[model samples]
Target chain A: MSTPADTMKSGPRGRSRGTRTVIAVLYAVAVPVVLIVAWLIWAGVSPQIFFPSPIAIAEAFVNTWLGPSLTNDVIPSLARLGVAIVLAITIGIAAGTVIGLTPWLRELLEPVLEFFRAIPPPVLIPVFTLLMGITTSMKLAVIVAGAFWPVLLNTIDGVRSTDSVMTETAQSFRLTRAERLRYLVLPSAAPRIMTGVRQTLSIALIMMVISEMFNTSSGLGYRIVYFQRNYLIAEMWSGIVLLGLVGVFLAAVFTFVERRVLRWYHGIKETERA
Target chain B: MTTVATAPERRRRRLSGSTAALGILGLFTIGALLEVLPRIGVLNRRFFPPSSEILTTLIEQLGEGAFWTAVSDTLRGWAIGLTIAMVLGIAVGVIIGSVPFLRDVTSSTIEFLRPIPSVALIPLVVLLYGTKLQSALILIVYAAFWQVLVQVLYGVADVDPVVRDTARSYRFSRWTQLRQVVWPTALPYVMTGFRLAAAVALILQVTAELVIGVPGLGRNLGVAQSSGAVSLTYALVVAVGIIGIAINLFARALERRILNWHPSVRRDVAR
Candidate 1:
């Protein structure tokens, strides 16, 4: 597979690097500019109950993020995500390693894992809330449940894909199971496992928000719904924007970590360029 | 020859029987536990509600017109939004993927936009279009489009150069070349994209309803939960899960039928 750098070099190169840089900056600015202009025009022409102008939303965003009143909401949502992701990665990797290492265990458990994964995690929120109650535990439980399967599945796949020659060489050297796993399997699987973690991070964030929206008294999700209920349109929009930014930030962080950890993976390097 | 065939048939029958028996036993065990635990006070009956109660409520909800209305509304939005998304996404993706310059130019923009969760856009959508079908459709479109576009782009870009060269040498028109050479080569990836989009559409459908107060299964779930009808809420949640599973199964079956010629399905069949 050709890398993005190679493609860029080979492709028709009419535009200079400086021109491309300018285009990239303009493209980045265009979306928000268009949105703001549209919002201003719409708010000017017709005032409605739920439609807030860009200026109003900006003011509201400052208040929500900077002010003490709503900062706790962001903290709760972030805290839930942080705790859930930590638990998910730790437990998922351990279980996945065990299952992936043993052929018999994998064969026996694959069906059950697939079934549970197929059942959408959000649909289980009600049951989770019932079992755990609408506390931080419930929120964390839902996020963990939702995020676990992807990482686990990917890790198993990665381990299973380890080169047979490497395993045989380790076996010929009389390497113990633990040593073989530690030296050979985990490194081979790390990139794929990281990919799974990247996928799960977004899902984890989504579930964190949804769980809060379902039952919690505070959080970004709750604040958005709360403000909407009270017809605080600007505040609601601000909350929505912050949630989007949070999603972007989390995804960026995951990608950055993945690149650093799996520097050998060519696809990651290509993706960075893209 | 007769004896050999008979013995193999008998062994196969025995294996299938054991598999079926095991599956049934597992299902029954779960069902019984879910039923008996709450009654025995090991599980909380108030919030958890017995499996039998959930079944009864499911039946009751199914009989009501409101349930059907919600289903239809959800399906309508999901189908319309997904179809539009697929059509436009595949078109744009193929064009960009085929043209190296455009793909390079837009790659950054696509990456930036793709990570923004479609659900997070509900407030902006509601602000622009209010709690209308348009807003719901927009959200679904946003969710479904990116998944398909990314897959389609990769698929188109990955098409075999040999096939393209052959098509060009045969003096095929641009449209003919695309139809004969590009699309068929990319069909498997396109199907995978559609499958991913289907799951995304359902999620967005329910989410849109939950957040925007649109009339769908999610709205019904929200109402039931808020009203303290814990049993009904649980039942509805299960119903939605079943719907999602059914949609997935249907898509998988369609994919198998369409891609029967592909090596992946052939390998599975051989196994």
Candidate 2:
């Protein structure tokens, strides 16, 4: 149905490219719209408590999230995520750089670092809760503990891979230690560090939700669980939707930052591909 | 001649041996510190029990039938969920990738759905299935399916257009073309997807159990923590950590076996 012969018979080659773009966009938009309509129809017909209509979800979403829940639940969760992300990145890079630069230390610490990395991240929540209690600091500790490893391990690997020639050149040029670090090391390791940071962001989110799932907390996770336990089905659905939005929002923001930071890396990759 | 050939090899062996020794020494140092810190009141003994106590507690857990059952439950959920996700992912990915119109139609939808983390569905699943294995299964499968699907799609799209056209011109039967061409090209990607999905499936499995109170090691961990069994909690955490490492090693080994012919795997093996 999509053969070149069929398209040639239908129209001229140059015009076909423009029409094809239009068709592709049309198909992309139409599919999701049709699915939503189908969902709306089914949701209307059945109308069960568990399966709330999209309209009901939308209304519940506004009532639950667009009010005090913003301050109490959403803000606290985002705040923890923001703080943990900063702590994880800073600690991971600082530690990773030092260890990576020292051959003996890297060898000594590799297994221990791996063991920490291999720990199923959520398991830390229980241990942290016991040690720190279910407070904000406890939540931050949980998120950072889980999120730190990827960045740390990745940074170590990245730093170790920094070109020896560049370091030698900097030394021969009598560059200051800080200048060598700033110019020769971090930029070279930036791409791998960004990869780790990307992973850390997602892990941080997962840990945030998980840490909130435990005792005494106002968070997106807790709110959703609270709604479920209380049989507020629509509100629960709304809370899940809000969580999804947060994930999407975070990913979008990351993509923007990654593009800016990795522009040089992308340029190099493009040239290499060419 | 023998001395010359073996000189570099001997040095390499010695270097590796020294590294291994250093690694073990590091482990011992940490262990000693952990054991001493609590005893000397540098760290709270209640919160950070000595390493020896935790190890003893772990040995104690190894004897318990319920512990094994919980471990098995987690493994079972992970296996079943990963299998379902792989099957559905490969089947759907192949179909979508083979059709240009379908791929274009679904690309945006897939992107939109992919970023919505599967853990977000925990509430809905809990509402539907309560704290059962089925609730956890929903989360595991949801997270894992996308991992496999995205990889399979990339693999299928990577099939060479010239090779496909040549096969079409030869009138190779669809089944034969798929078997000889598509499957071979897609197998490496499938292996990569399987590895990723394996990790995701385990994470989601543990998360669901821990959060939803399902019957798994994760739930056991929660039970231990809440009951104030401090040493037992550390023991369970260590057990789960070991399990995670084991799963990772198993996935890598399986990937190597399945993708032995793949250039990446071959290069890795050669190295």
Candidate 3:
């Protein structure tokens, strides 16, 4: 079978690198510039409640994140996101390694894992709420359950794909079992493991919002719903915008960390391209 | 679960002959534990019902017209939203991707907005459409749209300029050129995008139904939990899982059938 890199989806960058910089700098402003002008026109034609001018949204954005809403809502929401991702990575990796080592175990759990993976995670919210109550841990559990599969699947693939030659060499040297895993198994798998982490992180974030939406208080999702129900349209928009920004921020951080972790792998790809 | 029959191993373990049996036995053990643990007081039977009870609820649900209606409502959102996304995505992708300036300008904007979770829009959707079917459609369409759009952008970006210029010099009509040149190149990417979006749309449909209290299987799931129908809740969950699996399998089959002429399929055949 071909490696993932062979079939990896790559966005065409451009025709040439030289012409990209100048046109790119100017073109960068095109979307925001058009959107802002359209927003102005929309706000002008509409009432304050429905359209809520860009200025109003900016104010509400600050008010929501920096004002009393910060401690009451934003912090708690971020905290849940952090906790869920951490739990997802920890448990997913550990369980994935065991399955990887035992190929039969991997086959045994395939259907069960696929079932959990496919379930619209929010559907599990009601069951979790019933079993665990509407608390922070309950919220985290939903997020973890939703986030776990990608990491575990990737980790298993990573572990299973560890090079036979490398393992044989380690055996020839009579490396200790723990040493073989630490030095040989993990290093080869690191790139794929990071691939899984990236997928799981985004999933964890999505689940965090979904879990908060049901039977809860003091989180981004709850506050967004709360403001809408209360008819605070601008504030609702602010929360929505904030969530978008937070999503982008988290993704950027994940990409940065992934690039750092897989620098050697990426370098190899870059050299091959060159 | 283990869908394929394994080739016999050259270096076989003592228990290798019984591995398939072992996996089936493991599944039964899990089912038995689900039944026994709650009744034995190891788990709370009130909240966590036995497997048999859940299966019975699932069978009863199949007999109810309301359950079928709910399933149809969920499916309607999935179908309508996926269709809209595909149409809009291909159009926007072609328009934006054909122009270098447009692609460069919109890339950052798309990247910024795409990561925003569809659930985050519950408030915005609720504000606009309430718990109506439109609310579910809006969420489903918006979430799935990005998947198709991005893939199409990549597809268009991949169209070789040399081939494009060669066609231009031959004075090929714009429509013919697009049909012969662009469509074939983009077909695989479009199929990939469609499959991804199909799965995503169903997920968002369920999420919208549950979160917005829309009339669907997810809403039914919510009702079961709220009313303390523990067995029915588990049964509904199992039902949803089955639907998810069915959707994935259906999409995969469709993709494979259509792309049979592609090199990817040829490679698989060679293997």
Candidate 4:
């Protein structure tokens, strides 16, 4: 159960600094270098349909992302993600708090939540399509349904983990139920709640893409599907790379926000105290 | 006073078990109601099929040869991809986690690559491998690999120093040390990663078929839905849900059996 900080303290060093430096450099340069070399080698040999080349992909990326043809795809996808996440956080936290605060409510709700959580969101995409039709609303609804469970379950766990003593103190001090929830429970649950938010973000992204792929006409997912159907290999690869870049950016932002928001829960502080 | 205390305790025990049962019952009741309401015209039947029809369709599909064919094809891709992912993921994760410099250097890259949804790679895969089983397997591998790798890294990194020191004191060979000490300590995390990977593998399997038309349950579901066999589509969706649940339950059972000594499982058993 040693914290990551403790591992840093006592683990073997073994030229780790030099190794890290080499790894960093390789990661930064290796992908583009390898891709370019592969393109060149393929171009020299056959190049008809076997390879699309790195430069082709780059040009495709610029046209798709920078130029005005279908760049708005990214925005709609982002907007769906934004709506889903906001709904997930707000509803998830509210419902989780009520259930966590009351044992009877938890007992009544836990099984239903578990059943829904077990069902994959992709399975529900067609059903949503039927209900809402193949529109942006359907896509957003799918994202919301997919993202809701993780955040809700995590929030419940976070609230349950709140100190009983603190709860009792609030009671003794005659704090109203709402006041106690706002002042004590929410603050204590914030770290775990954030973790839930992180999980929801990933799920939301997946559903957003899946819904678009299955039913929609305009998002990044549709673009990927559309390009594939037309046999535009370069355009398709460009979309994939763009999506990967988007994933990386979102994950980085999540990690940064998580660290800043959950500063008090940092492993370094825990290890230092220990 | 003693009788009163004992009565409350007994009631509490009864309540715990009954509450769980009640929760499950409540969920099913709601589902049943939803099914019935649509049939009765209280809810729209066109949008939502009746529960009886969904069940009948599910049973009929299960009996069909095409359904089994779809199941086997999907399972083939899932099994091959998951096997490869597990082996490579664990090996790479262990190497990276055990070697500090490697871990630090690869951390950023891993994080960068981790968020790319495996389904997003479907287009590139189709282009490279063509619209076939390989495309589906590639997507499954991509989906499952990162999950297993991250968990394996955490597992290796979590190995207790006291155990490592004890092994060292015994002058155990490196292989022996790793086999006896590191592997056991990391087994729980690796298993957890496998469980998570299983879910991802199933999802990716279906997604690949749906997007690429790769002859699986997903393709069947898509076909059924598009052809306006609404009941059949719902039935297939339910079948997929059951498969997912079965995989999860099997993983949990396996974990409990394998990690009987682990504190979490031990506590559950004691309860």
Best by lDDT: 2
Encode model 1's per-residue lDDT on B1-271: one tens digit a residue. Answer: 1111122232233255554465455556666888999999998788768889999999999999999999999889889999999998999998988776667667766887788877777656766777688888998899789989988987787677777878889999999988988887787778878887888888778877875777898888877876789889878877887787778777777777888887766665664
lDDT of 2 by residue, A1-274 (tens): 2454245334556676778777667866988899878879999888787888888899999999989999999998898899999999999999999998898998788777877787878889999989988888888999999999888987887787789999899899999989988987888888878878877887888888878878765898898889988999989989888888888888888889989988998998879855
**Candidates 2 and 3: which is better by lDDT?**
2
Screening candidate 3 with a backbone cut-off below 3 angstroms (N, C-alpha, C), the clashing residue pairs are none
lDDT of 4 by residue, B25-144 (tens): 777777798788997899788868887889999998889998999988887888898999999899999888877656765776677788987778877777777768999888888879
2 versus 4: better DockQ goes to: 2
Sort the candidates on DockQ, descending order.
2, 3, 4, 1
Q: What is candidate 3's lDDT per residue for B1-271, written digit by digit as tens? A: 0000011111122235575576666677778999999899998888878888998989999999999999999888899999999999999998887766567678888988888877778888787788898988888888899989988987876676677778889999988888878877787788878877998899899988888888899998998889988899999999998999888778767866787787765555565
Q: What is the lDDT of candidate 4?
A: 0.79
Q: In candidate 1, what are the lDDT values of residues A3-32, reduced to their tens digit?
A: 453456454378778876776676556655
Clashing pairs in 4: none
Output the lDDT of residue B20, model 4: 68
Off by over 4 Å in 1: A1-59, A101-112, A160-169, A267-274, B1-26, B59-66, B127-132
Query: What TM-score does each of the candidates earn?
Result: 0.82, 0.91, 0.89, 0.87
DockQ of 3: 0.44
Better TM-score candidate (2, 4): 2
Best by TM-score: 2
